[model samples]
Target: MTESPLTIPIYDGSLVSVRSTGSSMTKAQLTTGLARRKAEPEPKWKSGELPSKYQCPSCSNYLRFPVQFEDCGHYVCSSCLPDIMRVASRCPTCQVPISKDKLVNDKTLQKDIQSLEVYCTNKDKGCDWDGTLRDFPVHFETCGFISVDCLNGCGAKFEKRFMNKHQKDDCPKRTVSCEFCKTSIIFEDEIPHLNVCTEFKIPCPNQCSTEEYPRGKMQDHLENDCTKQESPCPFNECGCEYRGHRPDIEKHMKEAPGIHLNMAGKTIALQKKLLQLYEERSNEQKNWIEILARKVNGLEKNYGAQYIWKIDHYSERLQEARSNKKTTLFSPPFSTSRHGYRLALSICLCGDGKAKGKNVSLFICICRGDYDSLLTWPFSHRVTFTLLDQCEDPDNRRHITYAVKPNVCKENRPFLGRPITDRNASFGAQKFTDLDAMSTLEYIKDDTIYIKVEIDNEEMVPI
Candidate 1:
């Protein structure tokens, strides 16, 4: 987009023609217009030339609004007369004593000075303007070569041709807007203004939507104005889903007491039933885990305890299992301690995709151990599984990690001991890393790879 030029309007509207550069009159035409009516002697002086009598003795310039000395009748330009007295009380040319009181307006000389034609002071700079002294001021106003100070106060000067470019692209004083607050400020001050502008946008604290509101008014809006904000029912916990502006919701609760009480009663009843079901499921999972723990404990005593396990030649094993030719491969049972939880890792070559297996699924499971009731019912451990690369230190590691989901409530959980999730949820490549990506994983070495499970007591694994 092109920027408009900065033009100061000419005070004398008649000067508008100063902008035109085209010539309608030729030199010959102009000469004929000023020619004598009949053959006559050539004059000693041209129209614009000042006769010697009209020159200022002090300044040696064409006399303007000449002031005559009453005693000597000598004319001096009004401007030079002032300085002439400063240098000496006598007239510069005649050496006659002169003073301001003896000076009087010389109308004849003034008229002559005004009629003299002169070239514009800017003509050398490419302006072809020509006019009498009386019209010089008007022509100068619109001269293209005249320089102007920057309108934006940037301490720069520009000619008409470059004025718009400087103001639009280079002036530091130009106006700009702050990105965060949308406030207008000078270009140089934009960054600093944004740093302190209080109007920057912020999201509603109630999370009603992604739309943002101005930071300055957010608190008041959230406290008394937001519509999506929720408030407790007058009859607390009435299972009401009706949320609205604070004032409207409050009015509803007060006017609808009877309806609210009925809702409150039903909500309480449902909550109680939910608690009962949760207790029943919790007891069931506790008993089941206890049984498995006992069996695991007896087996461990017979076979030395192991806390880490490995599966070798993974690709081959997956292919075999997928053929319905033994799908489940079990890891040697392991425990963190004799009395701690007994767990095992399990894998299936045929994925549940039922495509007849193109993937692998892994799981962590609970095994019956000796310390059943005496130990923690729901195991809480951070499990990290590493698929070890056959290569050296840095290049040989790929991790598949999961935090064992606690039996928060047996009734609600998908299965026990974190149920190892589904093929899509827990250990499947689709869940941890895509199967195709796993094929390129650095950890798979030779046809064999090792898996390690470590427990971090300090980290609480999130579901």
Candidate 2:
């Protein structure tokens, strides 16, 4: 006779047969048993004690499936008999030879064991289940206190009663689709995904009349479409200070032409005044530079006692004098000796006093000198003036020359004495040369005239 497989009741009330091998259950059977029991609450013995007759002889545990040996009339738990038979082919208690055909189901012992009362293993965690062993497995499968993994594979464990709630409301791996973009994402990542959703609507931050726009189009609206944005007047650089909304500014330009014109005119006037001030300052700086250059030139010519005065823009100077813009021009100062009297030459281009309009007038002025105290008063020095000719042949050139000796008398003291001011009054020829003589000669060439002034050092009076 073939040995019968031990059968156990599962959650669905279907019987699963457990076939044993030499010393263990088959892997597939072991796995199925573990999986079924993994979903159930663990059981606890609630009855005072289990009777020894219902316990397995090999394992000493309460019998799950009791089996009898015909040869020895001995009983053992079906769960433990495979291990016992693998060691020896005999009843573990009576030493009688045993075989697969000699084993039979002990239904009487099983009935007695099933009647034992037990409590739910989760009783310590607030479960109050207490029932006969026959009902324990079924109740455990449906127990609200049983802990199980989330069905969504989110790796969270909670009571079976809360499984539905966690999967529906709180599981991080639960699939959710965005309401605006309709993109699918996990529940926990929904908020971050919405932050970049292109289709999401947002109100304009500028608080313009437009209510809202798609997030991706909001910047374009603010820059190009908003009429309520403030802008400066188109004529702002012309001194118009008006600033307003786009529509209001358009209206302002159309209504305020006279005001803008006045502003522009005033701006032009202010610029002209600033230009005039700049020119005056420039002229003053030029004068100071000329003075400094003259000082440096005087030092270079200390022992020479002669100066070549170059008059440039001859035609311009003549026209200015004729127009009364300027009448006289002075040469830079010179000295009689290295430490002697300082003097300067002056010319009236259009003539002066008795020579007016007929000839050019020339004069000499006594300028204050550093060594004046060591020189005699009523300055008596023989001075000479020469106007250069531009003729190529020096032999044929006729350079106009004139000499003068200052009269040492009280009447001419102001012109001959040591200067008490920047210079004593100029005194010299009223008609140095006629205008017609100058025009006929090479005295003026390339719009330039050169005049030479020299002090006769041999005749210079000393203290």
Quick one: best lDDT, which candidate?
2
Cα lDDT listed for each candidate: 0.59, 0.76
Per-residue error for 457 in candidate 2, Å, reads 99
Q: Give lDDT tens digits, candidate 2, residues 285-368.
A: 999999999897665444667888999999999999888899999988877777778889999989999798999988989999
Candidate with the greatest TM-score versus the true structure: 2
Estimate, for each residue in 1-463, the C-alpha lDDT of model 1 and write its tens digit.
Answer: 1111222111111111111112231111111111121221111123546578877776666655456776787876544554565557678778899765555555556666767677766566676777677677577777777788999889998775678788888899998778777677899987677656778777898787788877787877776667766665555556666665677787887888888888978988998999999999999999999999989755654342334566677788867775777777778767655565567777664654443344455566666666545555455555665555545666555465544444446553443343233211223232333446456766566666566666543342221
C-alpha root-mean-square deviation, each candidate: 27.4, 35.5
lDDT against true structure, model 2 = 0.76
The true-versus-predicted C-alpha distance at residue 240 of model 1, in Å, is: 30
Over 4 Å off, model 1: 1-53, 70-73, 99-104, 142-144, 160-165, 196-463
Shift of residue 5 alpha carbon in model 2, Å: 10
Query: Following a full C-alpha superposition, what root-mean-square deviation does model 1 have from the true structure?
Result: 27.4
